[model samples]
Target: MVKYSEVIWMLVLFFLPSQAWAQQKVPILIYHSIDEFQGQGSKELYVTPENFEKQMIYLRDHGFSLLTFEHWQDTSKVKKPIFLTFDDGYKNNMKVYSIFEKLKTDQFRPTATFFVISDFIGRSNRLSKAELKKLADSGMVSVQSHTATHPDLTKITNYKEELEGARDAIKSITGKPVIAVAYPYGSFNSKVMEEAKKYYSFGLSTTPQYYSENGLKNELFLLPRIYIKYSTSISDFEKIVNGG
Candidate 1:
């Protein structure tokens, strides 16, 4: 027989909310050119290969589990789950592959999502079809869609071409399911979300916040991503991932 005080304690424990034990804040970091900035494009968009390597090392040393959107369900299951995303499929992003290779261990297997522009493949500065396929097949990167021409989803009238067409193109190249789309310029509206739902399981935006489930409608389609830019120092990266 339990005492009255023990019975009261058991009742409180049984009624505790499950959310209190669930992982809430998940950092979804976005990067573009993971290479040195030339005079050609925005300097802020370029995170140097050295700095990118340091950031990954920090994550590895600090016990972070690097993830792609393919492992999204594991966010609640894994310890310190975070998503690394790259946009535009820049040719320089191959540096990221090299860095991940150098840092991978049995304990730390780095993975990321490459949101590639379907029609821009094989451009002088973008990843060619063969290169994109290589990365996708490496089992370290998930190739997703950034639309056929990187058009702002909110302003586009041809939803089928930009959304479904882009998804199909990436699926053909990667031979893997294309389940996510990062909106060009992080632009989207209600119509965009509706169209995206038809093609993607998740939709990413440049909203600069860690993801926390809020029970909102279509919340998966409105996922927010924080930019990991050239100036994002290790300390800043630490703070961002730590939910500070």
Candidate 2:
């Protein structure tokens, strides 16, 4: 006769692999600029508007739900929730708004998250406060913190100014609670994570790994993202989303 402990062990062995195999892995695609670089810029940081549009259209036709950062809280609601996150809030990111407008559907709403440096707003190429507000109000984009000055959080001396300050400033401008943060240069530590928990509900990193709901409880602050470079072809893009 099998003991209760033996039965429990057997059940665990049976379910663990099934859960791991069937687990939903959501891809959070990270992008920097959505414009053509005339010259003198990292190619990895730029994705031409034409390519960006094609990517969005491909996601639309393939039935992938483009998610906002807020949606990260409850992945159970959507079947294929993929996040399109733009870092550094360049003025060119406004192009994403137009692209999303063209691709909006009843089942597949194209929404994205913009991680802006709060202290750099209204600078020459960065997004101004008004533009950030406009994007936030549109119901298609989320304005989140990339920190007040976009410093490496692990090296910062003032955690409050870097973490809380950015959250407060963006919340004030967008009139929405700043619930998420993307680390600058994808840098962080236990110290950063401890401080981040005080203000943010979610944290993002550039680890080039896709996130799944099953793994999040232990790794919320270290959630990984896949980088989408300018040279990523349509075939590779499809594979990236499909977890190939």
Candidate 3:
């Protein structure tokens, strides 16, 4: 028997944007230090400059559009936008800028977000004020809050000190409005999300998955990002970017 409701459902599905039908997935890749530091720390956090360059080159050759976290709202213009974000503001993050300079093309402009610890700036192995200003001024890099001391949001006693406080500090240094934050330790709760709304327009989390405009419809604040670690090989990297 023919059903009127079935016909209407089919029409609605066909008329929606392909994003809904195809379930488009965008990879927001998260990185840390971009140096050859193989000492007594989390080795996973370090991706050698050579490997980083290779990854960026792969993206360029593959026709993926690179974007910073700030461009989340520019959905109308972006085509297959892939986010490259670095955490913890390590001094070696400048290597990111260097690699981008080498790979810039007429069709692609390299862009990334650097989530920094406001309290740790200017320390050994951490980004200094001068370095941060240079990266921010380049217009290719975005300096965002990773909390004032990189504390776990779920455990923090004062949200204002860690969240809004870091936003202000980065703004003072970079002279740009701080509108986003990558939660420290990828930790957040209902309370954290509530407070984050008071300061930031975008809140990035460390959950591992592919993001898309459709996904952002609900989970923009708790957006998931794929971690690019030292051990990530070329094949796995392809899978991550492809939303496998």
lDDT scores in order: 0.91, 0.89, 0.87
Deviation of model 1 at 139, angstroms: 0.2
Q: What's the ranking of the predictions by TM-score, best on top?
A: 1, 2, 3
- The sequence of per-residue lDDT tens digits that candidate 3 reaches over residues 160-200 is 99999999999999999899899988888878888888899
User: Candidate 1 — what's its lDDT?
Assistant: 0.91
Model 1, 1-244: lDDT tens digits are 8999999998888767564765489999999998888878788899999999989999999999988888888888888999999999999999999999999999999999999999999999999989988998899999999999998788879999999999999899989999999999999989999999998999999998889988899899899999988888889988998996
Tens digits of per-residue lDDT, candidate 2, 15-57, equal 9998767867889899999999867679889999999999888
Clashing pairs in 2: none
**Every model's TM-score:** 0.94, 0.90, 0.89
Between the candidate structures 1 and 3, which one is better when assessed by TM-score? 1
Superior candidate under lDDT, 2 versus 3: 2
Report the number of clashing residue pairs per model.
0, 0, 0
Candidate 3, poorest ten consecutive residues by summed lDDT:
211-220
